[model samples]
Structures are given as structure tokens and as C-alpha cells.
Target chain A: MRIAAARERKHDERRVAIVPDTVGRLSRLGVEVVLEHGAGAAAGFSDAAYAEQGATLTDLAALAPDLLLAIGPPPGEVLDTVRPGGLVVGLLGLATDDAILEAVAKRGLGAIALELLPRTSRAQSMDVLSSQASLAGYKAVLVGANLLGRIMPLQMTAAGTLTPAQVLVLGAGVAGLQAIATARRLGARVEAFDVRRAAREEVESLGARFLEVPLDAAEGEGGYAAAQSEEYLERQRALLAERVAEADLVVTTAQIPFRQAPRLVSGAMVEAMRPGAVVVDLAADTGGNVEGSRPGEIVETNGVRIVGASNLAAELPTHASQTFARNLANLVELMVTDGELHLDDELVRATLVVDGGEIRWSRPA
Target chain B: MRIAAARERKHDERRVAIVPDTVGRLSRLGVEVVLEHGAGAAAGFSDAAYAEQGATLTDLAALAPDLLLAIGPPPGEVLDTVRPGGLVVGLLGLATDDAILEAVAKRGLGAIALELLPRTSRAQSMDVLSSQASLAGYKAVLVGANLLGRIMPLQMTAAGTLTPAQVLVLGAGVAGLQAIATARRLGARVEAFDVRRAAREEVESLGARFLEVPLDAAEGEGGYAAAQSEEYLERQRALLAERVAEADLVVTTAQIPFRQAPRLVSGAMVEAMRPGAVVVDLAADTGGNVEGSRPGEIVETNGVRIVGASNLAAELPTHASQTFARNLANLVELMVTDGELHLDDELVRATLVVDGGEIRWSRPA
Candidate 1:
């Protein structure tokens, strides 16, 4: 089988699905590796590097490989280049990317949506969502600190003692936990809040304070947050407002999978924050966890800066691509049986959104 | 006595010599505080905040107080606004800002050049250079990390283990030491170089390895690096080339006081570095320590980014202003004796550059 990857076409998408290391990994599995020219340029991988690892560089349309890998669903034109009955694997958003999935089925191709990968111990190594979200959390703290007028760590010098900055992280999922860890590493006094009481253990283990609000658990499937009623959300926001006002830097990552992010901070809460405070909303690509956050733009209100982080993971393109490529390689290894392709693995059954000429996805009950 | 500060005219100067907290401190010293409109605005302090601390806000020309405070030497127009025999105090560069000093004496103003303050224990609390350089060092690492494509710290994610970034610091001054400390705080493996062998203790104390080039100590006055011969510099650069090539990030802070900064990283050495490596030159304002570094801008050569960081402490405006104002407050307190001004203190004598139409400054023997 021939495996290929093409350059992502989105203006802000900097990650590449395949890297030189992974090309070598797949080639060792007895599959031909091919990639379009300049595929990994944005992620700091040169075409020469891939070629040196024994991958062929050519136009995606001309190659027509048996398997295609991508960071996201490729454009329709690029998808049409794949041979009939071939396989496509990527973060095909099961809920939001209906148009692309429809096109995938019409083209008589089998597709593996990484987003549909089951959250089990066996699938941990191939969890792209967890891996990508970890990077986004790390980037959030750095971006917030850069934008703030003050420094993060407390400083004691000849002039005087400068107290450490107060950092508040909303939600305790993969992204939020990473943000807490990063902030703590920078010597910030970090506090995190999560409706899932189980997250408190992870937050406190990172040397951060876990805030407790008087509410029931909002646990959903696969450890993601469940939807809340308007009454519960309003009460929760009121409780969080105090913490928001006290923070020097706030990173909000309260995203419900495949749904709008819960609004944790309101405009009034932001106004109460001190002048020069910074708030980074990692959920801006969704509806946002903070009011007044605009995707892909930084806006200032009442002397506070609100960073609408659209793609925080993409900022660290090199490492993001490397980790993602490793995850993809693991899934590819599962599809190979006795040096030939097989679709019998449990992981394949969980992630395969489309069988040849048929769509296999259904809404969760 | 009346003390006044005006808004700095330089567009890039975000620091203010006075803050609201310092205004309260100065007021408690029995002096009238006057300020030009929006004097502290750029430093994240508001006019309302200053007024609340008992400061009088008006135009600089209108105030014409008994003492004038500034971050740099005031221009001829601002000097003209000060009353005859008034005192002007700030980080006045004795060698470069001669034109302004001449204007100060011609206007019969006594000026305190903070840069000329003797490095003694008595003057430690009032040492603005140390205070500001410390912030510059902290900011250099942040700028370098933000530009690079990889994370600074080591990670053992399920995808794999990522090694920590190797940070090489070329200088062991207050700024360089701070850079080492900050990088260590972010979990990067750090190595530092300094001509003064005494710096080894401080570097190691901050959990960083000190690179010792095969050279004798070049210790200068006041713990600064002394001038070196051309042959010595060439040998030093050759020794450092290997470390520079291995570093994911390099922050250069090797500046000789009142002299052009020493050239450290040559262009040839930079070309040998990996793609996406970042170098932040803290001495860019005087003269860059790295070749091809443009002051106040980021330039790219062979896919390596060179950030000529001019006034990096200004990037942390709020905290910088707070520390700077506190230092200035300490110096102001030394000038006052029992509700009256005194010019007899050792710090006052050392820092007072132009005293009543006469220049007390002579080159240090």
C-alpha cells in the first residue's frame, strides 16, 4: 500500500500530518511513502529531510496513493485525488465537518476519523485530542504572560519583593491541566476550577489550588464536560467572577466536546480585573468560555486584554507535528497484519467512520 | 520643594520614572509632586491613579517645578521648561547624551545621572541599572522561547519523551544570570558563559552549567567585564561557536559599560545553528553582540531568528516602572534631611552629574 500526505490548505493551519521520522517508520512497515512538495515546510521540516528518509515528493493529484494522512480533513479537490476504495485518516470532526464526510462517502473511500477514536487505555498512545490539547494548554500560559504588563514569577531584588502573578485556569481537562502545570513552572500562584470533582486530584498534583464551587458534577462521556442548565451556568458564572477579578492572568479552556464552550467569564468580570491583566480564551474556536472573545483577534475592554486563541497548538508547530505524526504512526501500525493491510483491529473498528462506499457514523445515544 | 515628571517623547519608551505608589512615598517625604498629563499612562499607570495619590497633573511647561524626574535626559525643550537651578534626575548616559547635559548646564540645572552612581552597598537600593537589567534578562528568555518552534521544558507524554531545550546564555551579568534562572524555572537545560570566572558560582547556583572558555579573567570595575584585546576576543568566539550551534535558544548580554558591546556570535556561527533557533541580544541598543542583529527588530538568517532586543525591560512596563520608581524613591529619600534637601550624601555626590552650571563628572580613574 502507498501512504501519502499533502500540505494543509488552511491559512492558519501550520501543522503537517506526516514528518520525516514517521515516513521512515511507515516505510519500514513495507508501505511506500509519498508526500506533496513543501508538505512540512510550515512545521520547519524541509523537503530534502523527507527525501533523505526515503519518501517520494510529488503532486498529491498525480500520486493517487492508497492511504492519505492529514491534520484535518483535506479540501474536496485534494480528497478527490485519492483512488477509489482507498483510505483517508485524519481529525475528521464528526459533528461539525458534515460536508467533508459526505464527500468522503460519495467518493467510495474508507475513512478513519481520529476524533472518533475511543478513549480507552489501549487507545491512549493514539489520542490526538489529548496530545494536541496538551500543547494548546502550554501555549496559553506563554501567550498570556507575553501580553501582560507584569512578569509571571515573583521576584526579590535590591529594589523590593515583587509578588508572583495570580493565574486562574478554568476547566481541568487536558488543556486546562497543562496550563496549570506550565503556570506553576513559571512560579505563578495557580488556581483551577472544574465541575468534574475528579479533576481536582490532577490539578492539585501539579502544585496548584483547585477551587471548589457549590455545584454537582458536570461529568459527561469520556471525561468531557456535560451541558448545564441556564440556572446552573448563571450561578457558576457568579461564583467564578470573583476568581476572574483576582487573577492577573486567566486561561479559560472549558470546552464541551463537539459543543459550544461553556461561558465561564462574563464582560463584567473582565472589567473588574485589574488594568494590564490578560485573559486567554482557548475555547474561542468554539463559542468561547469568556464573553466578548472574538476568534482570531485580540480585543481590549476596560484596560484588560482578551486573547481569543483560535489555534494555540499550531503555534508550536514543530513539536505538535512530531507528536501528531507519532500518533498517526501508531494507528497505521494497527492496520497492518502480517505485513499486509487488515481492518480487523479493535482500534480500526472504533475509528473507522466510513467503510468502502458506506458511512458508518451514528449519533451517540 | 516641588518635584515634577513629564511624559517621555520617545515612541518606544514605555517606562515611567514615577508610579502611583511612589507618588505616595514621595508625598510622605514632604515634597509637592507634579506631573504632566498622562506621564505614567504608557507604564500602565493612569492619570487618575496618580491624582488619587496626591499628585498635581498639568502640562510640563506649566508645572516648571523645583525638581524634574525622567527616565532619560530631557530634550532641550523639556529642559527649557524646568526652572533655573532645578534638579534633573534619571539614567543620563554620560558619554552619549552630552548634548542634553550641555543644555542642562546652560539652563543652570543640577542633574543626577543615575548611571554614574557608584556601585556601593549604600547605593544598592537606588541602583536603577541593576534593577532594569534584571528585567531585561528575564524578558530575553521569554522572547527567545516564544520565537522557537519547540517547547522549553521536557515532556514525557504518551506520544513520546521530548528532551528539554538547551539554552546557552552568553554573559553572566545581572541580566544573564536572570536569564539562566528564568530558563531553569521553565525546565530548560541551561549553560552560561562569562569571562569573569567568579560568575561560575552564580550560574551554578541557578542550576545551570557554566561554560569556561580557555581565557583569563577580564574583570572590569564595578563587576563589569573589562575591555579585551582583539586576539583574546577572536579566541573566545571560536571556543563559543560549538555551544551556540547546539543551543535551541541563546541570549547574549555581554556589554561593556560606556563602550560598544563586544561582538560574541558571528554570522558564520549563526549559520551553523539549527533551523528555528532563536538568539536574543540584550546589548542591541549599544551595539549588537550577534552579527546581523538589527536593533529594535527581529531578523532571520538561514532560518535562525536574531532578535535585537532594545529596551527589553520596557516590555514589562508595569513591573519595570514599579521597581524603577521605588529605586528613584530611595534616591529621593537620601536627598532629603529633616524636611529639607541635602546634597552631601555619598550617593548624591556620586550620582550628581551637573551641579549648578558645573559638571562634577570626570572619567573614572
Candidate 2:
């Protein structure tokens, strides 16, 4: 079987699904790896590096492989090239994009969407979302620290003692946990909040204080914080506002899959912050968790600087691509058995969006 | 006696010589504390904060205090406000600018330049250069880490192990030591170089390797790494070129007092570095240690970023101002005893630029 990887067509997307290091791993899976000439260029992977690993370099249209891999969901034109029963795999955005799933079904293409992979110990190695979110969380703190007008670390000089900056991270998930860790590393006094009780332990384990609110853990499907009731969200807003006002830096990573991110920080909270305070909103791409956050823009409101960072993982393309490519390689290795598609596997069954000329997986509305 | 600090007039200079925190200290020196309105505004000290500290705010030109305190040497018009026989104190740049000293002599003013303070244990608390340089060094690392296109820390993820970034710091002064410490804290593998042999122990104590250059320590006047011979500098450059090419980040902090900074990282050396490598030139304001560095601009040469970071301490205005204010206060307290200028003290004699209508201290030619 021929497995081909294509360059992501999205303008801001710099990550490639298959890296040069992963090329050798896929070759051992009893398949020929074909890549578009400049597939991994943006991620600092040269075409020569890919060729060094014995991967064939060619045009995606000319290769017409039996199996295809991508970072984003391939457009309609890309879907047209796949023969009947050919396999297509990527993040795919199958969580909410019904049109892409419908197109795959109509074209009789067997598509596997990594976003649907189960959040289990066995599937952790192939969890692309967790890997990318971890990087986004780390980058958020760096972005905030760089924009801040004062030093993050405390210093006692001949002049005077400078206090460490106080950083408050909202939503203690993969991204929030990483932000807390990075901030703490830079000698910041970090505080974090989460709807999940389990996140409190994780936050504290990284030497950060967990902002306690009088509410139960709103555990949702796949161990994520589920959407809270209106009353709970209101109470959360009130509790978080006080912490936000006291913080020198705030990093918001509250994201709900396929939905508008819950608003946690209000404009009043931002206004209460001292001048030179910085806020990095990681959920801005999916309709922010902070008031007045515009995606991909850094806005100064009153004295506070609010950065709406979208696709922050793309900014650290080298490592992001390496981690993402490994996740793709792991998923591909699981689904391909004896150089052919093995759809009966539980992991494969969970991710397969279309099979045998029909839509096989149900997407969340 | 009246002590006054005015708003700095130099472009891009945000630090104030005195802050609100030091107002009470200055009051203890048997002097009335008066401040120019908005003196500490850029450094985040509110006018109300200064008022609460028992400082009277008024126009600088109108106040005309007995002693004038400033960060930079004020212009002729600002100096004109001070009554002849009154004192003016600051980092007066006596090593190079004789015109300021000549003007003070011509005006019969008692002037003290902080840059000429003796390097001794008693004078350590009043070391403005050391305090400000320490902050500059710490900031250079932060600036480089933020601009780099990759992560500084190593990560062992399911994807693969990402290596820690390699950082090379040139010069081992207070700023260089601080840069090494900050980079080490961020989990980068740090290496530092210096002409002073005493720096090796300090560098190694911070968990960074000291790049061993085969040469005798060229100790300069006043306990600094003095200017080196042309042949010695050529040999030093040859030894550093390979390390410069190998490092992901190079922070150049080599500077000589009142002279152009030594060019350590040649343009050829910058070209040898890999694409996306960053060089933070801390000496850029006094003529760069790295080739192609412009004082206040970030230059990209052959895919390597060379940041000409002059007055980086000013960028961290809050702490920089606090530290500078304390240094100024210490100098003022030492010089003014019982409401009179005590020129007999060694510290006072060393720093005094003009006394009794004559240039008391001759500058280095």
C-alpha cells in the first residue's frame, strides 16, 4: 500500500502531519511513504531530510496513493483524487463539520478522523489534541511574559527587592497546566482555576495554587469539563473576577470542543487590573473566554493588554509538527494491518468517519 | 536642603532616578523631597503614590532644589535651574563628555558623577552600573527566548524527545552572569565566555559551562575586564567563532567603559550559525559586540537575528527605577552630611566631578 502525506493548504497552518523522523517508522509498517516535495518545509524539515529517510518525494496528484495523511481536513478537490475504498486520515474537524463527512461518504472514501480518538490510557500515544494543547499552553505564558512591562522573577538588588509577578491561569486542563508550570519556572506566583476537581491536584502538583470556588466538578464526556449551568457559570465569573483583578498576568485556556468558549473574565475584571497587566486568551479561536478578545489580535483595553491568540501551536511549528507527526504515525500504524485497511479494530472503529461508501461515524452537533 | 527629581527628557528612557518608595529615605537625609509632576509616571508610580510618600510635586523649573537628582545628565536648560553652588548628581558620563563637567565648573556648581564610584565593599550598595547591568542581562535572555522560533526547554513527549536549546553568552560581568542564570532557569543549556578569569567560577556556579579561552586575564582599571590588545582580540574572536556558530542563541554583553564595545561575533561568524539563530547584543548602544547591530533596532543578518538592545534596563522601568533611585539616594546620603557637601570622603572624592567652581576630577582620556 502507498501512504502519501500532503502539505496543509491553510494559510496559517505550518505543521505537517508526517515529519522526516516519522517517515522511517511508517516504512516499517509495510507501506511505501510518498510525500509532496515541500510538505514539511514550513516546519523546518527539508525535502532532503525526508529523502534521506528513504521516503519517495512526488506531487500529491501524481502519486494518487491508496492512503492519504494530512494535518487539516482535505478540501473537496483533494477528496476527488482518492479512488473508491481509498483511506484518508487527518484531524479532519469531524467533530462539527458535517459537510466534510458528507463529501467523504458521497465519494466512497474511507476516512479516519483523529479528533474522534478515545481519551483512554491506550489511546494517549495517539492523542493529537492533548499534544498540541500542551504546546499552546506553554506558549501562552511566554507570550504574556514577553508583553509584560515588568520582570517576572523577583530580585533583591542593592537598590531594593522586586516581588515576583503573580500569574493566574484559568481552566486547568492540558494547556492551563502547562501555562502554570511555565510561569512557575519563570519564578511567578501562579494561581489556577478549573471546573474539574481533578485539575486542582494537577495544578498544585506543578507548585501552583488552585483558586477554590464553591462548585462541584462538572465532568463531561471524555473526562473534560462539561458545559456548566447558568447559575454555576455566574458564580464562577464572580469568584474568578477577584483573582483576575489581583493578577499581573492572566492566561485563559477554557475551551469546549465544537462550541463557543465559556466567557470567564468580564470587562469589569480587565478594567480592575493594574496598568501593564497582560492577558493571553488561548480560546480566542473558538470565540474567546475573555471579554473583548478578538482572534489573532493583541488589544489594549484601558490599561490591560489582551492577546487573542489563535493557532498558537502553529507558532512553535518545529516541535508542534514533530509531536503531531508522531501522533499521526501512531494512528496510521494502528489502522493498517498487512498493508491493507483494518476497520474492525476498536480504535479504528472509533475514528473511521466513512467506510464502504457510507458515513460510518456520528458527529456531535 | 531640598532634593528634587524631574521627569527624564531622553527619548525611550522610561526610568526615573527616584521613585515614591525612596521618598521617605530621602526625607531621613534631612532634606525636603520635591518631585516634578509625572516624574515617575512612565515607571508606573502614580502622582498620588508620590504624594502619599510625603513628596511635594511641582514643576521642575519652578522647584529649583538645592540638589538635583536625575538618571541621565540633564540638558543645559535643566542645569540652569539649579542655583550656582548647588549640587547636581547623576550618571554624568564624566569619562567621555567633558562639556557637562566644564559647564558645572563654569557655573560654580558641585557635581557628582555616579559612574566614577569606587568599586569597593562600602560602595557596593551605591553601585548604579552593577544594579542596572544586572537587570539588563536578565532582560536580554528574556528578549532572546521570546524572539526565538522554538521552545527553550526539553520535552519527552509521546511524539519524541525535544532537545533543549543551546545558549552562548559572551562577557561575564553582572549582566552576563544574570543572562546565564536566566537562560539556565528557562531550561536551556547555557555556556558563557569572559576575558576575566574570575568569571569562570561565577558562571559555573550558575549551572552553566564557562567556555575556556586560552589566554591570560586582562584585568583593567577599577576591577573590570580592560581593553585588550588587537592581537589578543583577534585570538579571542577565533576561539569564539565556532561557539557562536553552534549556539541557537548568543547573548553578547562584552562592553568596555567609555569605549566602543569589542566586536566579538563577526558577520562571518553570524553567517555560520544556523537559520533562525538569535543574537541579543547587550552592548549595541555603545557600539555592538556583534557585527551589524544597530543601537535600538533589531537586525536580521543571514537568517540570524541580532537585537541591538541599548538601555534594556529602561524597558523594565518599575524595578529599574526602584534600583536606580536607591543608588542615587545612597550617593546623596554619603555626600550630604549635616546639610553640607562633605568632599573629604573617598567615595565622594572619587565621584565628584566639579567642586568650588573647578573640574575637581579629571576623566580618563
Candidate 3:
């Protein structure tokens, strides 16, 4: 179907919906690709590249396509260019922003949020959050490595054998695994932990050690960790005091949907660790896993440095934009037909959080 | 050589250096084992069981074995019972404690800390940290699942299609991978990341997608991520903001040796996420990955919950203790013989952080 990919309205976003390579892939799937001029410039894709790939180069007003694809929710002015009854798809956080919801409703536009897609096996290929989070996870480690003072792997040189840096990862999702594998490859002794009992094998298979504890039954369900009872937490703290004190580096990535971050690290724990240890808090933006964590700030306490960096994925814009563009392309391939659009696909239906001019799935309000 | 298995000093520690079954293995190696009353109680092993397996039950004062085995460092009074020139092996953080070092010297004893074992191929079996960390990783996800407010997997119930929770893991080490696999088994959509590019395959092999990024050539000699320029960090942050905003749950696990945690998440990024989201910082002990994280406290900001619970491994102490005991047992099997000890093995030499010692391997002044 015909889709107009507009420039991302969010400042500092280098990603674009329709990269040149994706335009060719979409063209093969009978889709007409439209690009806002220079949309892919920040990502190193030129407008001419889009034209070479058979995409129609046109202004937003001239190319009033039936569907709009964007990296984020379209800006207000850009929404004005949509034809009536058109569909717009992107990362629409409809639960919080009334303005965007109101804008879509006023125009009777069908809007779907990639972020709102239900996480399921069948929907995995169309999941944008997975795609982007993977990128974020990969980047977060690099950010941490760059900021850390010492090297990760052990080295035997004529001067002396340099012991590998000890790395502790806090979570075991995609990003955490990547960090573990990455750290291990770099010769760093990597260790990680998560709240999922089922994660032990995967962690061990990677050659990294897993940290275990006697968690309350309430701490686990269906393999995912549940919010712990206060008593369970106290016991956890008492048991973990020594382990935390021994680690050289720590990375924390633990979060639950639409909730505040769980405090896993304490000031006492930080105090217990040796000075100059670095912690990368992936949850800094949401809150932090560390006691003195501040988003986008480097905090030093008792000679220990805590860096709260936000948007780790954005740090690697080139690859992030490429992956995002590919994800968008896959999503478009699911609904495009003969250079036109079909909004009836289950993939589209499921992710259509704001359709028929109303907020259909608003995270239970 | 002969060795004495002592009672655990910590009240909750139930594991002994040798289980009944393993005692058979040790006896075959010409090792004589002595038990001190109730060493294996927590692991369901009785002194009779050890005796049945060819271990001798003896009083500490009479045993005066060449090797002493216990779950933590040998208590001060217990050191007095060791024969001069005897060996003591366990999970000892001697480098961090002057008391432990002094005790080893005062007693003229050879002390091997399992935690200090080098991350070498030969030391794998004796690696206490790896064994325990692996279990900790598995349990962390279970803990998170128990604490999570929703189910991990998708279900097609007659009521409606239940959506799987979106789980984001912060680190990619052993604990992180276990968390990913555990979450996946429970039906949650799991995503993970790490700094080292080498982790991509491990993450993908587990059915989770790996996030890729454009990283600088900052990897250290052992494939560890080396520190990067500030410009690189800014770029990274800009990219991760959107991904963090979309995740329902985030688990952070990033730490550097001898340093404070690096802040991976920003407050604005957390604010950007939908309310009611949850974050668990596994690095809560050494500080956290979230901005407003507090150790052992669940902080809510603008409708989001931040849980900074440290020492997740301790939450599953029963299993943790079991694994730790197994590791200790394996280590004890390496040097104890005929109710005696041998301290000349390469493994012992490398792990003996304090032996007739005075800060054997002190941190740089």
C-alpha cells in the first residue's frame, strides 16, 4: 500500500521510517514508498538513495498517501497533511498524551502504536519494542565499557598479567544477555542475575555465572519475577551484602510495565563496594536501581562513580536507525498490497491502540 | 590427605563441604573426610550419612586436620583448631578484610578463598562465584516474576487473549541470560543487550533478539568494552530514550570493577514511559540503574514504581547455599587427602589470598 514516511518530530532522533534498502524490499512486496526529503540523512541514507530504490520522492502535501509511517507519533502540523480516513502508525504513547490522542480523533484517523503491540510469539516479527530494546541493550554495555576505568578481559603481557575486569549485570533479558556475552568475549569475567528461575540454564550456557538466592514463592511466577514481599527483600539484602561488596562493576536493568523502578542497590551496598567501581543504570530514566543514581548525570559517592545515562540506544544512531527502519519495513510488509494499504491485518488490528478516533487500549486507564 | 568439614558459621548456611554422595567420590581419591557434628544439615545430609559414605565424625579439637573446609571464612576461634601449616579453604574475601588476613597469619595457616580463584580454564570446577552466580541468575527472574503484577506469557482464555508482559533486561551476563530464558518460558516477551558484540549470537540462540548498535573501537584486549569518549555516550543516550519509554518492565544490571554504577536510564526517559510500569534494579546493593532508586524501597514517581532491591541472590539462599556447597566440595576434593591437606597445587597457590599472610594481594596504595 502507499505509505508516506515523514521526518521524525522528536528532537535528536536520527531514524527514519523508510530507509533506501527497505524501500526496495517494500517495493518487491508491492508497496509504494514515499519519503519526506532528507528523512534518512541523519542515518546516512540520502534522498537520492530512496529514489534509486524506486520510492516516490514527494512533499507531505503532494503525497497524501493512505498510510503514514513514522519513527514517533507525527507532529501536529504533519498530522494536518493526512488525508481523511488515513492510517498512521508509530510509537504512540496514547495512554499518557491526550494531545496526540485528541489530534488523531479529530481527524478520524486510524492510529496504531508499535509500542502498544501485544508481546506474543505470533506478533514478535512486528514488535518494535523488541527490536529497539535489543538495540538499546547492545548499546548500553558499550556505554558502560567506555565509561569504566579498567579493561574487561585478563591479559598476559611482558609487563604483567592484567586481570580481567569483573562485570555484574543486573538483568537477564535481551540486553542483559548481550552484555554478558559481550563482556565475556572481551575477556571480562561476567556475572548476571534476573528474577526468572528459568533463566539459569541460559546464563550458565553462556559461560557466565549466575547469582542465586532463597527467594519467596511470591518472587516468581511463570518464570518472571514478581514484586517481592518486604520480608523477602530484607532477607535478600542480608544475603547479598557480601556479593555486592565483591563486584567491580554493576549493570542494572530491571523494570515492570507502567510502574516505578525497583530499588535493588542500596547506599550501603555502594559503600561496601571498593571505590572506583562503575555502575551503568539502564533504568536511570525510569528511576534507578542504584541509590544515588541520577539520569544523565555522573554521580560519585565515596570515590565510586555512578553514571545515569539515558537513551543508550540513541548513542549508536547509525545501527539503531537501521534496525528501526528494518522493523518498520517488516511491519509495512505485513499490510501493504499492490502499492496500497490494508488496515484489516491482525497485526495491524492488534497494535491499533487508537483506532476509530478513540483510545481503544489505554493500559487500563 | 585428611580434611575436616566444619559446621557453617552463618545460621542459615546448611551446606557442607562434602555431601554423602560426593564423599564416595572423595574417598575413591584417597581423601579422608571428617565431619564436625551437623555440617550438612541444610542440604538434607546428616552426619550419619557422611559416616555411611566413609567420612569420620570427629571433634574439631581432636581432628586437627591438615585441611579445614567450611562455607564462609573460618571463624576466628575455629582457626585455633587448625594444625600449624594446615590449609583452610572456602569463600573468603580476604583482600577486603584485614581481620581475615590477620587471622590467617596469626594461625600460620594457608587460607584459600574460593571467590579469589582465577577465571582460568583449569579453575572452572573450583569456581565458587560461577556456580553461585549461575543459580542466582536463574532465581532472579523467578523473583521478578513473583513480584510482577501480571503474567509473563500470553494466554488465550475464553475471557480474552491475555498479553504477555514486556520484559527488558539490563545486563547480558549469566544472570541476564537466565532471566531472558525464564521470562520466555513463562510467556513474556523478553529482550536483552550487552556492550560486547560477541553476545549477539548467545542472546539470539535463546530465542531472544539481540540489540545491535554502532559502537566505537573501545573494546579492551579481552573483548571487554573499553571506556569511550563523552561524545559517544551522548549519542548513545539519545538513542535509548524511546526504547526505555516503551518498555513495561525494565531490569538493570550494569557494574564496573571498583567503581560506582553507571547510570543507564534518565529521569526524563522514565517519565516518558507509561505510568504503572515497574523497574527492578539488581544492582541495588552497589547503587542502582534507575534515577530515583532506593535500596530496599519501592519508590513511585508520576505513577511508575521503582524497586531497588539488592542481593537478589540471597533471596534463593537454599539453592544458592546448595550450589555454593557443591563448589566448595569440589574444591575440597582437589587438595584434601587421607584426613590431611596439600597446599602445593597450582589451584591452591593461585587462590590462597592469605596464607601465613600480611595482605598477600593488597589493592594498590
**Candidate 3 CAPRI level:** incorrect
What ranges in model 3 sit over 4 Å off?
A59-63, A94-98, A214-232, A239-241, B1-365
- Candidate 1 lands at a TM-score of 0.93
Q: How close is candidate 2 to the true structure, as a TM-score?
A: 0.87
Task: Compute the lDDT of residue A60 as modeled in candidate 2.
Answer: 64
Model 2 residue pairs with clashes: none
What lDDT would candidate 3 get against the real structure?
0.68
Fnat of candidate 1? 0.74
lDDT of 3 by residue, A1-365 (tens): 56778777676676777767677877787656788787776655667778998888877677676788877778877888777888888877553353677788888887878876778776676666666665566455555554443444453321123366788888787667766765665456877788785788888887889877664575456223333556655665665666667776788878665666788888998898765477788878777888899987889886567878576655544445656667777777777767666778888888886676776765553
Best by TM-score: 1
Cα-lDDT of candidate 2: 0.84
lDDT string, candidate 3, B268-316, tens digits: 8888865446777766656677788887778887656777865454444
Candidate with best lDDT: 1
How many collisions per candidate?
Answer: 0, 0, 198
Off by over 4 Å in 1: A214-236, A362-365, B214-236, B359-365
By TM-score, rank the candidates, best first: 1, 2, 3
Stretches off by above 4 angstroms in model 2 are: A6-9, A56-68, A73-88, A93-111, A213-239, A337-344, A354-363, B59-63, B76-86, B93-111, B213-239, B337-344, B354-363
lDDT of each residue in B120-231, candidate 2, tens digit only: 9889889999999998998898889877767888988776688898999999999999999899888899999987778899999999998765445444352233235676
Better of 1 and 2 by DockQ: 1
